[model samples]
Target chain A: MKTTETPAPPPAEPGASVSEVAAPVAGPPRRKKEGAVLNVFSHGVLVIWAIMVVTPLLWAVMTSFKDDSSIFGSPWALPDRLHFGNWARAWTEANMSGYFLNTVLVVGGSLIGTLVLGSMAAYVLARFDFPGNRFIYYLFIGGMSFPIMLALVPLFYVVNNMGLLNTIHGLILVYIAYSLPFTVFFLTAFFRTLPTSVAEAAFVDGASHTRTFFQIMLPMAKPGLISVGIFNFLGQWNQYMLPTVLNTDPDKKVLTQGLVQLAVSQGYKGDWSGLFAGLVMAMLPVLGAYIIFQRQVVQGLTAGALK
Target chain B: MQHGKYRFIVGFLAVPLGLYALFVVWPFIQSIYYSFTDWTGLSPEFKMVGFDNYKRMLHDDIFWKSLQHSLLFALVLPIVTISLALFFAFMINVGGRRRRGGPAITGVRGSSFYKIVYFFPQVLSIAIVALLFQFAYNPDSGAINSFLRGIGLGHVQPLWLGDPSLALWCVMAVLVWSTTGFFVVLFSAGMASIPGELYEAALIDGASRATTFFRITLPLLWDTVQSGWVYMGILALGAESFAVVQIMTTGPGGPDYSTTVLVLYVYQKAFRDGQAAYATTIGVALLVVTLAFAAIVMRLGRRERLEF
Candidate 1:
C-alpha cells in the first residue's frame, strides 16, 4: 500500500530542457575523446537495430504497392507503379469493409463493457470493507490465470445455447469475460492510488455511492480507464480465436479472422497482394492509437505487469 | 451508514460478479463435468464415463507427444524471448544515459523508433504472420533460402518449415520475433520504474554499469520478470501451433507431428475428427496443466511487495 511521493518539480515545463535539469546536479563531466567514441558507437548500434526492426514492415508496405510482376522480379525494389488499387481491391474484394465494421463494433462493445463493469468492481474492492472482499478480489485475480482456450468448448456450447453465435453481442460477451481479469486488476490498483478522502467527503455531503463513483471517482480514474480501454481495444480488435470459434458467419467475422479466411482462400494463387494490403490496413488503427497514446500505454503496461 | 455501505458494495459488485459467474465459473464447472461424461458435442445422451478418458490419455502417444512438445515450446520460448528482451531493454535503458555529442541515440527518446519497429509484428495478426512466413519459407520462391543461396550459404539453407527437425525451431523463431517487442516494452517499463536516483547512488559508490544493473535493476525488476514469464508462458501454451503448421506443413502436426501442440491436437481431434469427448478431455487436461503451472509459479515467486 506504500505509494511513492512525487519529487518537487524544478519548473513547470518538465520536458523542455534537459540541460536545465542536468545543470542543477554537479556530476562528472563527460571525457572529451572517450565520450566522442562511445557516442558514435552507440548511435551506430541503435541505427542498425532500428533498420532490423523496421525492415519487414517497410517490405510489407513496399510489397503492397508493387505490381504482380515487380513483386517477384524486383522483390526489394520500389514499385514501378504505385498500385493504390491494391488497397481498393483489398477493401472491396476481401470484404474488409464488412470486417472493419465488425471489428469496430466488437472492440467498441468490449471496451465500454469492460471499463464500466471493471471500474465498478474495482471501486468496490478498493474502497469497501466487506465480508469476502479480499476473497472476491482473489477470485478475479484467479480469472487472470484461467486460460480462455481451456474453457473454449464449454463456452462455445453456452454461446450456442444462448443463441448468440455469429452475433456481435456474443463476441462482446466473450471479450468482457476474457478481459475482466486484467481490467479489474489494473483498475483496482489505480483505484487504490486515489485518495479516499474525496469519496468520503462526497459521501458525507450526501452523494450516493453511485453518484460519487460516476461523478468523482470515474473521472479521476480516466488515465487508468484509458489504459484499460486501449489494452482491451487492441486485444479485441486483433482477436482471432474467440470470433473464429463463436462466430463463423463471414458477415459477422472480425478483421483478424476475415483476413485469415482471405489468406487461406487466395494465398496459393499468388494473390496475397490483397492479403498484405489488408494486413497493412488492419495494422493502421492500432499503430496510430499506440503512437498517440504511447506514453500512457507504456506506463500502464509496466505498472500492471509489475503489480 | 453501515447499511448504506453494504448496499454500495452489493451494487458495485453485481454486474462483474454476475458476468464472471455465468461466463467463467459456470462454464468451468460444466467443463469438469463434461470431462467426466462421454458427451459428444452433437448428442445430449452421454453416460458417466468416469476416468476412462484420463486413463486412455495415459497411453495415448499423440497426446503425450503433444504435451511434450507444448512443454518444450513453453520452456524454451519464455527463456529465449525474455533473455533477448532483457538484453535489448538494458541496452536501451543504460545506453541512453551516456552523454553522446551527436544525438540522443541510446535512450527512450531515441528508442521510440525501435519501439515502433519491435511492435510492428504484434500488430500483424498471427494468421498474417503465418502466411507471410509461408511465402518467406517457400523453397522455390522463398526470400530466406534465396538470400542464403545469394550469400553462398545455400548448403546451410534447410527447408525451414518443411523439415520436421527444423520446422519446430523455425516456428519458435517466428514466435520469438513476433513477441520479443512486447517483452521489450514490458522490461523497459520495469527498468523505468527503478528510480534514476538508485543508478546515481550506485554510480557514486564507484559501481560499474554492469554491476549496478545486476545488483540494483535486476533484483528490483523481479516482479516484472515474473509477470512477463507467467504471461508469456500462458500465451505460449494456449496459442495455435497449427497456424504455422497448417500453412507450412499442409497437415495437422506437420512433417510427422513435430510441430503439434496440445491445442492443435485438441482442434484436430474434436473439429477435424469429431471426437468431442476426447477433445473436451484434452481441453480439461490442458486447463489442469495451466492452472497447476500458474499456481506453482505464483507460490514460488511470492515475496513481500517492494516499495520503490
Candidate 2:
C-alpha cells in the first residue's frame, strides 16, 4: 500500500459523514414519533447552546466599549456609555490598523493565488487519466497529514534564503503555498463531480483545455470555487504562527500576532479596554465577512464533512 | 493531441507543484536533517552530533510534562467535545418531532438560527477566542466569576486560568467552548441525511432517545463520529490548542509552566532559547506521537464495524 494511503486525519471522508446525514429527507411521509415534548426539549437545548456560544463574543464587544477600570467595577454590566476611544487608541497607537492592512493584503493575495493555481492543478488532476496523476495528487494531499510546525525552522531557512521573510508579499506566497493542499484536495473532488461531457464538448468545439477550464468548466465549478475561496480566506486571515515566525517586522505583522503582542503589552500596562478593542479589531473583518457569506463559508469549509 | 494533453497537465501543475516543493516538501525534508545535528540556526558552521539532542530530550523533565499534558488533552478533550457535539447535534437534527404530530423527522423550529449562532466561534480567529476567554476567565472580574457570584456560588469561584491546579482544566473548557459548535453543525448535517424512517423504526421498537442514538443514529454515523474523533485527536495533539496558553497564561506557558504543552515547548526552544536543533528533535518526537496516535485511532475505528 502507498504511504499516501495513510489517511490524513484532518478530512475524514467528511463528505460521506456529512452528506449521508444531510441527504435530503424530502421523500415520502412515514409514521414517526409525535413527541411534542422532544421538540420542546430540542428547542430548549439549542437555545441554551446558542446563548453559551454567543454570550462571550457579545461580552467582548461590550467590554471593548467600557472604561478600562470601570470594567472591574461592573464586570457583567452593559457599558455605562459607549467609550469609542478604545477603538481609536487601538487603531492609532496600538497599531491594529497596520496589522489589519497587512492581513488584508496577505490574505487577499493568498486567496487569489490559491484559487487560480489550486483550481488549475485540481482540474488537471481530476480530469486527466495520466501517468503519475495519482502520485501527484497524493503528494499534494499528503502535505495535510504531517504536522506543519515540524517544518517551521527549515521553512524559515528556505524563506530567508529566498529573501522573502518579513515582507507582506513573502507572507502571501507562503500562505498561498501552504493553502494549496486543501484547496487542491477539495477542488479536485469538486471537479471530478462536474459532468465531463461539457468539457469534452468544449474541447471538441475548438476550445483549448485552458479555455475550457476557464470558461466552460470554471463557471460550472463556481460553487466549489466560492466555497474553497472562503475557506482559504478564513484560514489565512486568522493565521498566527507563521507570521510570528517569519515576520519579525512589527509593521508587517498580521492582526493575530499584533493582538497577542498588544494583549501582552497591555497585560503589563493594564490597558484592558484598549486590549479588548484590539481583539475586536482583529475579529471584525473575518466576522463581518463570515456574516455576509456564512452559508458559503460553512458549506465550503464543511465540504469534505458531508461527502 | 497526446502531446497537447501532456503540455496542458504540465502547464497546470507547474506553479503549484513548484511552490509546494520549495516551501512545504523541502522544509519538511530539511527539518529532519536539522533535527539530527547541533545547529544554533544562525551560523553556516555546525557539527553533526548525532543523537545528542535526542539524548537530551530523554532527560528533559518539562518535555515529559508537556507530553503528559498532550496525552491528557488527547484523551479528555475528545470525550467532552464529542459527547456534547453529538448530543446537541442529535437534538438539533433528530430530536424534533413533526409539528403536526407523527414520526416525521424535522429539525427544531429554529435549527438554522441555532446553527449559525453555535457556529459563530468557528469563524473567529483562535487568538481572538483565546483573548476573549482571557477576559472571561479573569479571576477578579471576569464573566465566569461574576456569574458565579450572581448565582450565590461565590464561595466556589476558582481562579480559573490563574490557579495552577485548575489552569489546564480552564484551558480545556475554553477549547471545548470554541470547537463544540463546529462538531454540532457537522453532526447535524450528518443526521440531516438520515432517513426519518429509521427514527420511526427505533420509536416503534420502544427505544429511548439515548438507546435510539446508540443503536440507530450512532451506528449509522459511526464513520462521521470516527472521523471527528481523529480530527479532535490530531487537534489535541498539535500546538493549535496552545493559542489559549500563549494568550492567557503567564511565563510563556505558566503558572510555573502548569499549562505548558509540547508544541509550546518546541516554539520556546526554537525561537526563545535559540536551541534550534534540539527544538527540531522535539518536533520530530511530536511528529512520531501524532502519527502513532492517528494510526492507533484508525485501527480502533476499523475494529468496530457495525455493518448493517
The DockQ leader among the candidates is 2
User: Where does model 1 exceed 4 Å of error?
Assistant: A1-48, A268-270, B100-109, B154-156, B195-208, B240-249, B295-308
Q: Which tens-of-lDDT digit does each residue in B124-203 have in candidate 1?
A: 56666776666666665565665566656658667767788887877777777678888887888777767777776776
Per-residue lDDT for A120 in model 1?
94
lDDT of 2 by residue, B1-308 (tens): 34389889999899999998999999888888988899888776778998898999999999998888888888899889999899888877776544444445665556677788888888888888888888778878877777777767679678877788888888888788878988988888788778888888876676667788888888888888888887888777774676777777877678877898877888888888888888888889888888888788788878775344
Q: Write the per-residue lDDT of candidate 1 for residues A103-215, one digit (tens) a residue.
A: 88888888899889989999899888888999989988887776566577777778888998888998898889888888988989999999989888988898988898999
After TM-score superposition, the amount by which residue B8's alpha carbon in candidate 2 deviates from its true location, in angstroms, is: 1.9
Q: Model 2, stretches more than 4 Å misplaced?
A: A1-44, B101-103
On a 0 to 100 scale, what is the lDDT of residue A146 in model 2?
A: 77
lDDT of 2 by residue, A214-294 (tens): 999999999999989888888888887788789988788889888888877886888888888888777776778778888
Model 2 B-chain TM: 0.95
Q: Model 2 Cα displacement at B98 (Å)?
A: 3.7
Query: RMSDs, each prediction?
Result: 7.6, 7.8
